[model samples]
Target chain A: MANVFHQRLDELDELLVDMARRVGEAIEHASAALLAIDTEAAAAIVAADEDLNALQFRVDDRIVELMTRYEPVATDLRFILAAVRISVDLERMGDLAKHVAKSVLLRAPAPAIPDSLREDFAGMGQAAVRISEKLVRVLAERDQMEATQLGLDDDVLDALQQRVHDQIPDLGYGPQVAVDAALLARFFERFGDHAVRISHQVVYLVTGDVHLDRS
Target chain B: MANVFHQRLDELDELLVDMARRVGEAIEHASAALLAIDTEAAAAIVAADEDLNALQFRVDDRIVELMTRYEPVATDLRFILAAVRISVDLERMGDLAKHVAKSVLLRAPAPAIPDSLREDFAGMGQAAVRISEKLVRVLAERDQMEATQLGLDDDVLDALQQRVHDQIPDLGYGPQVAVDAALLARFFERFGDHAVRISHQVVYLVTGDVHLDRS
Candidate 1:
């Protein structure tokens, strides 16, 4: 019975890990669509979000079921709770990607952001996606070191976001353009922060410690 | 033994209710300070935030302890989870209030906002605070009707925020002032949305239904 229960738990873990990976892919694809102004890719990211949301619901159900049926204790209980919270963060990340895609569709044909700003946005997007990927791996392997490293990477994204803000006026764009740039920068910064949150959850899962130099 | 456990749970609920009231009061006081540009009031609000944060930490710890100690089931489990989430929302509302106070301090003695736009901003702040207060009451009584009404009130705040946004450029402020006004509008809109979220949680707690009329 214990072996069977362990197998079931592993299966649930696999499902959640796949969902997190897909969320990261959606974020990256949506960023690409925004940069290329590709309506098709943007639409695809938007449509894919329903699947992510459904997966989140299913994962949550599974976690609750495990808690009730298996009565997991100690580390097992922590893992299940973390899984539920991480699923929420992942679902929100997917929603944020869809929001970015919608913004892309709103400004179709005419580029609201210039190439210089676009470079910073893309860099921030890639960093965010990388953090998400690293988070899944850390959770799957219970890797404390990689999880800690992901937290550090967030500072890089924050610095880049600050530079993007500083460059907004120098971009010499109109009011609407400047506003869009500022909002987009904010989105990227928030995305990075959410990624760090996931990484923090991973560290908690492994070490049973919630505080990790929040500075 | 069961009676003792029930009594403890009731105490936890009372503490949570108290925290919710404190959070609402903090937002209300902070908003008034911002509109009046009262630095002393803002400072007091900022100082009071430490108490809110300390209460939040205590509440979180108590919840975790209760969950681990009693291992509540079904509705009890759901209620505890919802309480945890609502506490987080309340903490965030407190932080938003602090941000508003910081903005007031940054602007100092003079009214940073123009007279023409003052009414719209005051309207938005008042709406946010009122909605927050309603949500706290809904949580205290678990009132479905009050929760739904608060959701509708949030819509009014949203519309007022839109008006503030439209009036931003016409206020004849410099670029920096325009940006600050835009961010201020956004902060109030977010505070309103947090109130809506609290209402949704209340509906869930009362009906065990997560799907609320978010429109």
Candidate 2:
């Protein structure tokens, strides 16, 4: 029975990493659609978010099942709980990606981003993609250092988000353009927040300690 | 042992509702602050959010402790899990309220919502307060029917949010005003989202079935 529980934990971990990869791909596509102005890719990302949601439900169902079967104790309990938290963060990240894609679709032929603001969004998109990719690594390797480093990247995204907000009055775009720029900036900032939360969850999983500052 | 477990569950439920009440108060203040441009009220809401966060941590710690001590199964297990989910949703709701307050703080003396947008936001804030108040009742009373009705309020909020987005171009506001209006619209939409999620979670707790549409 104990061996079965351990095996299931391993399987769940694998499933989590798989979910991360899919979510990362979604973010990557969102970034691409943002720059390329490809509604097709954006539409695809929007449709594909369901798969991630389905995946989360599966993860959640399994977590409940594992608890009922094994009644995980001590570190095992914490590990399972962390899986629940990480899965939620990943699922939210997926939704954020969908928001990015939907932003692209909303503007359609006009292109959501203005020419002058494109570089800032490109940088924000790049940082978002990088964070998503690294999230997979953090979950798979359980690398404490990697988890810690995620915060640094989050700062980069934050700065870019601030730049977007600061430049809004000065972006000198039309009303629709300004609105899209502001919303896009917020979406990227929120995406970065989820990444930071994932790292916090990972750190808790590894350290098994309630965080001080985060509290 | 059964009596002790039941007693603890009752205490946890009380704490959960208290948290809800606190969160609801936060939303009310945020709504008032948004329209009044009262930085003092807005700043107060921001500071008070940490207290809500602290309350959540306490709720979480207690849930874990209850689970560990009682080793709950079946309904008892589900109850504790629901507590965890509800606490998180409420914490997030509190944060959303803070964002509204922050929006007010961002503009300082300048009102966040223009005169034309004020009526729309007033309506949104009223509905939000109603939802938060109802959330308290739903949790405390275990009123599943009332929980289901929360969805109707969410729909109203969604429409208001749509109106905000639609009105941006025609509002004739400056670039900064447009940006704030768009983002504020989004914040209200997300606040409505958290309310619907709470309803879903309550339904799940009552029915013990996975939701069909959300996935």
Candidate 3:
């Protein structure tokens, strides 16, 4: 029974890693769609969000089933709870990616961000993707080292977001473009945030360190 | 043992209700700060968020303890899980409130939002407080009626957010104010979103329905 419980925990980790990978893809694709103003790709990212949502439901169901069948206690119970929280973060990251996609769709045929700001956004997108990739490793390996790196990566995303905000006024874009650019930067910043949150959960699970930053 | 377990569950509910009430106050205070351009009130809201974070930690400790002691199964198990999820939403609502307050602080002595957008923000603030009041009742009583009403309440918030967005471009505010206004509106919208999420968890606990809207 103990071995089986461990195996189930491993299975749960695999599911979380899978969700993180898809979130990374969604972020990458959404960024591409935004940069290229590819409405079709944006639509695909939006559509794929449903799959991530379904996956989160699956994770939740499996968690309940595990608790019902095994009645895991102490560390195992905490680990399961962390999995539930991690899935929420992963699902939210997917939604953030979808929000990015929707922004592209909102300005179809016309680029959502002005060219002056594209380089900063491209940097933000790359930072988001990098953070997500590290998040997948953190989930899969429970590596505290990788988990800590997510915070630094998120800091980079935050800086990029700030840069974008600073540049918006000088670009002389209209309100619609400015609003979209602000919101898009925010979406990427928030995507990195969820990744950091999931990594914090992993760190808590691995090190029993509960100093979570709920910012 | 079962009686004690049920009592512990009640204690958990009380903690959650307490958290909800504080979150409600945070939103009310933050909104007031935003409308008044009261930096002092904004600072208070920011400081108070730490209290909410501490409260969430308390709730989380209680939850882990309950699971450890009871190993609750089936419906009880699901209820506990829902509690975990609901606390997360409440904590996030507090964060959104803090974000509103921070926005006010960012432009201290000068309003973060222009005078023209004040009416819409006022409306958004009122709607947020109303939704939070309903959320407190939903958490305390598990009243599916109040829980369901949250959706409609959030609809009001979404509309208010939309109105704010529509007005932003026309306000002729520079990029900084425009960015701030856009983020402030998004913050309020997200607060409503979190409230709705908590209500959904309450409804699920009451009715065993799981058609959650993660949008």
Candidate 4:
């Protein structure tokens, strides 16, 4: 029975990892759509969000069922709990993508963002995507070192966000343009934070320490 | 042993309820400070956020300890898990209040928000605060009815927020005023959503059903 339960737990983790990958892809696509003003890609991201939400609900249900049936203890319990936290984080990342897509759809057919603003947004997006990719790698391998590095990546994203803000006032754009650029920067920054949070959960799963320095 | 564990769990619940009340009060105070443009009150809210964060961490630590020692199952396990979720939601609410207070501080001692915008902000704040207060009460009493009602309150807050946005274009305010007001409305809407999430967690704790109709 124990062996069978362990196999099932592993399967659940695999499923969650797959869902996380899909969420990451959605975020990447949404960020590209925002930068390029591609309404089609933005729409695709929006449509994919329901799938992410469905996966979240399914994973949550499975966790509750496993807890009821197997009565997992110690590390197994922690793994399931960590999966729950990561699922919520992934779902929110999906929401963030949808928010970005919505912003793109709202502001499309208008003037393109200034070159400086676009470069800042693209850099932020790339940093956030890299963090998400690394986070998944950490989870897959239980690499605490990689997880620890996510904290530093988060700081980088924060600094980039501050730079974006500083440029907003002098971007020589109208009010709406500035607001859109700021909102886009914010979405990318939050995506990085959520990725870092997922990495933190991974470290907690492996080491049972919740407050590992991400920096 | 079971009885003793159960009694201790009850004490934990009471502690959580008290912490939630403090968080709700802090949110209300912060909102009032924003509306009044009272920098001192806003600063107080910012300082008090540390208390909320400390309480959240303490509650989380206690829950973790309890899970380790008791290995609770069935309803007891569900209760502890719900407590963890509610703690996170409450902490985020504290953070939201801090965001509002920071906005107030940033925009203070210059042009006060006009009366129309102030009324909209007050309405939004009142809706969010009322929902949060009701959520805490429902959690303390396990009142599923009140918990269900919070969903409607959240919708009302969202509607008011929409009205604030629609009026933004007509306000003829400067660019900064419009942008700041829009962000503030967004904050209140998000606060309402968090309150609804807490209520949903409460209903789940009571009934073991994730989809409770708040309508």
Clashing pairs in 4: A151-A214
- Across B79-197, the per-residue lDDT of candidate 1 in tens digits comes to 76666666666776777777788888988876656677788888877787778778767877888888878878788878887787677546565544555666677777777777777
Off by over 4 Å in 3: none
Q: Which portions of model 4 show Cα errors greater than 4 Å? A: A111-116, A212-215, B111-116, B212-215
Q: For model 2 chain B, where is the 10-residue window of minimal lDDT?
A: B206-215
Question: Each prediction's DockQ?
Answer: 0.32, 0.55, 0.73, 0.32
Candidate 4 is scored at a TM of 0.90
What tens-digit string does per-residue lDDT give for candidate 4 at B1-215?
78878888888888778777877787798888887788999889889888877777677667766777776877887777777767766777777888888888998875345567877788877887788788788878989888768877888888988887777657766545656777777778877777777788878887878762221
lDDT of 2 at B75: 77
**Model 2, range B45-104, lDDT digits (tens) per residue?**
999999988888888778777878877887777677667667767888888889999999
Off by over 4 Å in 1: A212-215, B107-114, B169-171, B212-215
Model 2 spans with C-alpha error above 4 angstroms: A212-215, B212-215
Residue-by-residue lDDT tens digits, candidate 2, A1-215? 99999998988998899889988899889988988999999999999999888888888778788888887886787777677767767888888889889988888877888888789888988888788778888988988777767777788889988888788888777777888888888888788887777777778878876663332
Global lDDT of each candidate: 0.73, 0.82, 0.89, 0.76
Q: What is the interface RMSD of candidate 1, in Å?
A: 3.3
lDDT of 1: 0.73
Which residue pairs collide, candidate 2? none
Winner of 3 and 4 under DockQ: 3
Local error of candidate 1 at residue A45 (angstroms): 2.1
lDDT of 1 by residue, A1-215 (tens): 67776787887788778877887898888888878998888889889988887787677667667766665666676666567656656776787788788778888887646777888888878887877777778767867787777776677778887887677656665545656666666676667666677677777666667652212
Estimate, for each residue in A1-215, the C-alpha lDDT of model 4 and write its tens digit.
89988988987787778777887798789878877889999888888888888787788778777877886777787788778767767777788878888888887765335666777777777777777787777777878887768777778889988887777656665555655666666777777777787887888777777672222
Clash counts per candidate, in order, are 0, 0, 0, 1
DockQ of 3: 0.73
